[model samples]
Target chain A: MPAGPTERPTIGVALKWVDLRPEVDPLTGAIHDDLHSFGCSEADRAALEWALRLAESWPGGDVDGERAEPPDVVVVTAGPAEADALVRDALAAGATRGVLVDVAPDAPSPEVAALLTGVLEGADLVCCGDYSVDRGSGSVPAFLAAGLGAVQALGLVHLEREPSGTLRVTRRLDHGRREVLAVQAPAVLSFEGASAELRRAGLAAVLSARDIAIDVVPAIAGRVARTQVTRRAPYRPRSRSLRPPAADLDVRGRVLSLTGALVERTPPRTIRADAAEAANLVIDQLRTWGYLE
Target chain B: MTEPRTPDFDVIVVGSGPAGASAALVLARAGKRVCLLERGPFPGSKNMYGGVVYGRILDTLIPRWWEEAPIQRWVTRRGTVIMTEQQSLTIDYRTTAWGEAPYNGATTFRPDFDSWLAGHATDAGAVLVTSTTATGLLRDGAGRVTGVRTDRPDGDLSASLVIACDGVNSFLAKEAGLYPHAVPENFTLGAKEVLALPRDEIDKRFGLTGHEGADFEIVGCTRGIAGGGFVYTNLDSIAVGVVLSVTQLATAKVRPEELIADLKRHPMVAPWVEGADLKEYSAHLIPEAGYDMMPTLAADGMLIAGDAAAMCLAAGIWLEGVNFAIGSGKAAGEAALEALVTGDVTAEGLAGYRSRLDDSFVLADHKRLRRVPELLMSERMQTQYPQLMCNLVEGMFTVTNPTPKKGVVALGWQELRRAKVKIRHLLRDLWTSVRTFG
Candidate 1:
């Protein structure tokens, strides 16, 4: 972290590269013959967008009536050489620089986390998606927070830095509830899909980003593996039986019957006969779902 | 000749379709600084075509291109089929020549083909900027086009020359006063679907071995509307679609998608694509107005090529556009080079562009088939001719018990009568067809 008011803070974004297979493939389990291009995972895009947004609103720790300068945004990812495209995309999405951690495609989660920890050492705040779209392990942010000894917030929808240097975050909870928390610097926040959509990368930025030099660092050894893939299977679509209108019914009867069947499938359970009864029903349902406890 | 560099690039090519990419490839290979701008995320992400790439212009650019390009199949069999609701008449010709080296034609999916072609341009040292729309043309004080104004921030890119290869509705050409707003009658709406099947299954169904494929062009399946249907085989997929006259489609009051669905259910077409799964569905506007709707090819510091200049040929027997685009693009490239060498990048200097195209097969073919669009889009050709042909073929093949067979000419006349076609109109159409096609 920088110390002076003129010094800009560093915001780190962890990215994951994915192989995007074409949407069309034969049902005979044959490999897709279409070309595959490199793309960043959706969750990683959301986190990067959030990091860029937060950097724009950074207060700069200024107390002398000077306008606040934006923070420097840096993106870090670990993968093979092809992952350079992902880092370039992040730069086009408004990152100041990029760090590519050289690793294999099958690098374990713990090893990736350790490499990311080394790259994000001096950053004031580090952000990542809740999980990779390809591998929904939902554990990288936790592992990274533990390795960095920083406070971790998962599923954040909103984040901003206060003038006093504390980070305010809003996490979406179940049943339309939100949890807001304020923490000190050097924290890790994992974003959910509820955050704002990523900005469209401009062509100029994309062309310029192609020229930015990506710092490639070799991976560190001695990390225990946490997971292993054992099996591979092609997607099998579930067969659904067709439910047509009854042959004996008229058109009006068929329409009415379909509507009645839909209503019966999800019948409303509670009837608000009175205020007291409604309150009792709510409380009983909450207790039954274990939310009351 | 060389001069002091004043602009950002020597040439700026708008759009990355065949024309733009080919121009960029030629210019960049000649050691000129060029920029290829595309409005899509990538080159082919926004481009669509019916599925056939006819002609050998590509061979001159990238020799034996099919060996490395994403070519789906080389067409070995091709013909047209005239269809009535329940009957059909096909005139197909197949040969081993088309499958050998220097093939006649080939089929490809645009998404794969366009990107690969653009890649060649980039490999030859052209800077390809995707997702950047050229909003307007930059003009100097004397009203000469100097560059393009894109949709990017501070995206005013200046160049000595600008080539507008943008597709049918080219904003740059329209802004430069080269093309007028297109009318509905001058355009055609094409909708296509990619149906995926197993490679072996496709090979077995189409009776093809190795990379051989077939192309079928169908008529009289548009429900009396002015259009036609087509089916082209890919490696493991079939591109089936229809091209309709926009003017007729609007009054026909039928959805284009429904028209394709009805085409898929045709008795003759259903068996070919029965069990295939739909992979992708797309639609695009094609500039079908042959030589009549062509825009001004070149002006001061500006040259228009490809569909933006209405270089597509939508004649009856030969429906082609990509080849013409590539041909015109090569001519434009050569002309631009000449203009650059003489240090006179102006309308008078670039006049060689039109002359080069006139000297090539692009202009000659379009000029010869200038009346085909009018003939193909006529009410009689769309309905009566196909109905008459199908009826005559049906009559010739059917043998009724205890009845004598009529002569071929008599049967044709009887079918023509049944289709409510007058002999005078038939004679006139035949004369026009012969004169126009020959």
Candidate 2:
């Protein structure tokens, strides 16, 4: 639904706090907080890009048009003081204003959503990354939508502005499927990292935004309790549970059996046949490799 | 023409390395709105130097900096080694005082140290703008530098004063024609590799304990190139590298890494760095011509500091740079502040920068030791002298079994004649050294 001429819609973009390059202690394998270089993550930047696009195409939203009335883009993030730089960068990238919910670095996603919920009131739509690069739980958007009682469209891979001014969003689904939905204002949309590329801010915008004061509000209490990390380990993918080769077989035989080499082996063949038969043989080989049904 | 534009910042300090950071810190502390621009992602991301940093200049800027600074190790042992392919004669000195409070010199990764110093400037109220390259100087119609133009769109920032501390290969200083004598011969390329070892392993191999470190300055290890090699200890690693003359290196077609490899594989050096894993490899250009190649320190509305001003001291016995950089940066900052207060941001007004540097150790040391760089890079110092000294030491230690022992003078003459060094050349170097360093 399009906003009335007098009413300017507001799009809220959720930026995540993450270190672009984190220094790790060689001895302890721990992150050195003082050495962290922070920047906007791809997923969060894509969400902001989606929000900007929404604002650009909205009714009376053309920047160069005579009656320019682009929707307000409010960027919000919840983290410690260092996160203020992230908000400043978003403002430089064309955010109308920025709000930093001052929260602990270890604050849970639900708590961060609760903190953002208070500051992002009356925003017509909220856009968020599918997940952050650091603490990638990706549950804040759902919690925010619940808090605002807004329609939630998660896992958005594509978004377009319809002529009628409603937002048409395509969501990624399991098994390479997509679900297209017509999203109205007052909806929470979460976007994937590849959805859009964020525009670079000129130095003029950066210089101007450097002095604009970002609203830093304290984090409200969350209903969910914080969880402690008692143990840290590198992520290990689950290994395939392969059947053991016959114990009596030789080592080479066992290796070949485990690799399915014996079953896949094909001897070189030479055939004097028509071109059509050779083409059929090539197609059959490709089919055997599962390249075709 | 239009009216002169109001300045965006009181001063624009280009490059946030030690010099720019120091200058910004001083000006910001004086209540000047300073903008510090860095081309790298962070303060020292693009910076690399030979292992140890002599940080005595930080005493005034950061009280008890040793307590909080990101120091890898305190150099408790200092050694100067003369080497041949298979032999080394080391002059090793160890003092516990260097490992204690108010330490002498330390080993640090530049990225950590540079950022830590830049953090102070920002904390003192300077706006640090990283990843912004100042492409050119913004000059007024009257040919006075007003500010800088960056690589970004609408990146023109105006300021009353501009301090170029933009490291070696500083395009800003070159654009301003401050470096009339800049040439490839005036610079040296230093390539370093950091090898990681376990803490206990490093302690055992390098004979270090409790955050103590060792630094070795090796002569005759540059494969006859007019430069030297350095091997210093970090907390859990060792930094081994070589500095080679840029012209000699290019002429010989020898890579800098091969020199590092040769140094690491040297019989004496191999024991210390054996089995260590290569953690990182970095290379940087050092401005080594000393006083002769130093750029004009000040111009209209501008002052050059740090490596951009060629303040590195590459004298043989005292190879130091970071301290000189910090020293010059502090002077530049103070001079800029005075100029701003006096409302004379002209070439003559900023002349105080030169006087301050001359009075301080930055210029005084460079001036006193100006002849040392050329002397050290001479063929006699690079090759013949090292061989003569090594053979002399070898001859002294190996006593004759059947024949009578030769006198020390006879042995010295024998080694000198065998190394093909003339007596007159050695005496000339001796007199030059005594006059310059006496």
Candidate 3:
């Protein structure tokens, strides 16, 4: 691992190189066979190929597709213990440094940090997607900040590396408005949709990735000193399209927002309903599904 | 039809109405490659629900479908009546078989029904492209319709044969010069409104139980014009409309919407639609000019089906158009596919389209009722006869209620003389009907 930087924040990103789903073949009931769909038009296939090329142009990341080289950055991913051998092989193959983010789906927050801290004790930086595609909760990275006792920025959109080994960051806020902030080299940053276009790895990069492996350890998150109880139902497919805030939500002005805007009400308004009670319902539901503290 | 998307497509059907979709569904189920194009955003968005669909023909397409399809109800009550100034002499029929699994008849919302059919086509590997209208036949110099040109970019698609299932006022028909314009006043325009109500409330108001529905056809209500009004029961709403001759509506300068509003306000009509919310109100033109409106079916390159061929029969009593649309669409599909296999999409290859139609009663029904259109225009139906009915029925019920009025058990001649309905006009009108309808 690289020596701890006295002034620069170093970070690692998490990704799962998931393949196309295997369930697609069951449309005709022969579920376990090698099946390929040929129903698409030629033009549509051309469009997908073009999107892949755009994904390969990014300047950073440990994996290189086509002519792009790795930017001295390592992507942290975890699955079964069998993947440990792959991680060891990658570190042995010319990768001098690594940062492990506790990414196990059902891992306790404290347990995740315990494992990550042991592996990344020397690193001064961590990078995370603002919102994971599956969850989009916009949480985990902030929680990591509390667990690891690091200064964290939860709204990271743009980032650049300078010659002096400093990292520049930008954040999204107030409906198309943005802010630039910097912290001396060793803090956590979150990524959101504001990040530059996602880069897709080509066949050559994927083959090269087989040599990369990551070590996993248990991370122990301390007891939750505070809890927010909120109940929100799962989204329905038909009602997925969300409109902008109605005139009621006065979100048009500037405020250093640390959370999503709250619902607006008429003047002289008072809410009799217990906010904690509503939150408790949500926490209870998540706990029932083994996803809560 | 072998519409070669540069290699293989078992069938390429044009239009997305009942005819095209049904054909595509059948061919696709047999493991054939099918491509169905719709000009509208969806099937039947361009359709006019002018009459009750004949549920029998649909039975052939989707077996016992009322259990699942978005059907209003199975029709149990049907009425055809003539009204006078104060009296209506009505004829009604009540059939219970209409409620059984193999239903005798059912009311349909065309957009819902046709969209469901297009879904079946999709499941059978038929690609349905919506919002794309086929402009004209792309023909080889040898005069075979080799493909079609569409309004979309890069939409020049090749096919072995073309089937025109476009409806009543088909652009393809006129562009091909297959259908001639109807004589003045021969066709009619209909405006309809679907009013929403709860299902249970609709049943109680319409005097039906379970899935029984009603269709009430009116006469003498067009106000001396050559048409009347209709009310058909749907799932949770009532469909009401008036069909009037284009010529009469133009001359009287009365719009169909205004006429329908008047009908809805009628003391009797208003009660049936009470508490119902207005959902959709639209006007559609029907080519009921019949023989005069018939379009040529076969050309060198294509076959015409459905309302595009002017296959609707007004029946003088009411309109029945959807079943014919489905049947003709099926027949055209079968003929088109056969023509593709034989490599003969010529006029001769399509001659089977008409001949088979003759056997299937789609064409036969039109031929049988060929004279009914002209015969419905007897002068008595317009003037002398209606007054006679009003005078006769109203006089039969009306009374001076005075003394010595033949003991009040009689329809006296004195009451008839008071109405100016002379014996000469009534006799001549009666004789004209005997020579025509009798």
Candidate 3, lDDT over the whole model: 0.63
Candidate 1: give the clashing pairs: none
The parts of candidate 1 lying over 4 Å away from their true place are A1-8, A19-38, A41-43, A56-71, A80-82, A102-108, A200-204, A218-227, A234-293, B1-5
State residue B330's C-alpha deviation in candidate 2, in Å.
Answer: 1.2
Q: Which candidate leads in DockQ?
A: 2
Deviating ranges (above 4 Å) for candidate 3: A1-293, B1-10, B29-32, B66-68, B84-87, B182-184, B375-384, B403-438
Models ranked on lDDT? 2, 1, 3
Q: Chain B TM-score of model 2, please?
A: 0.99
Clashing pairs in 2: none
> Candidate 2 lDDT, tens digit per residue, A1-293?
33455567788999988776666765566775642567657888999999988788776744344465678899998888888888988988889999988888668778888877787777889999988877678898999988877889988988898886678999999999999999876888999999889887777788778899999897666456778788986556699988999999999989987888758557889888799999999899899999988
Between prediction 1 and prediction 3, which has the larger DockQ? 1
The true-versus-predicted C-alpha distance at residue A226 of model 3, in Å, is 19
Q: Report the C-alpha lDDT of model 2 over B144-204, residue by residue, as the tens digit.
A: 8998989887788889999999999999999988989888999999999999888889889
lDDT of 3 by residue, B1-438 (tens): 444446225456777888788778776776666768788756777887755666678777778666677777888888876665455666888888767877767788777878777777777877776667778767676666666777765566666666777777777766777877745566778889999887899998889988789988877667677777888898788998988888888998877888787778876678889878887898877777675568788777677888788777766664678777778888887787777678787899778888878898687767666666655554456444556566666666666567434433245365446545677766765565465344
Off by over 4 Å in 2: A1-5, A23-34, A61-69, A104-118, A135-158, A169-181, A192-197, A220-222, A225-229, A233-293, B1-5, B399-404
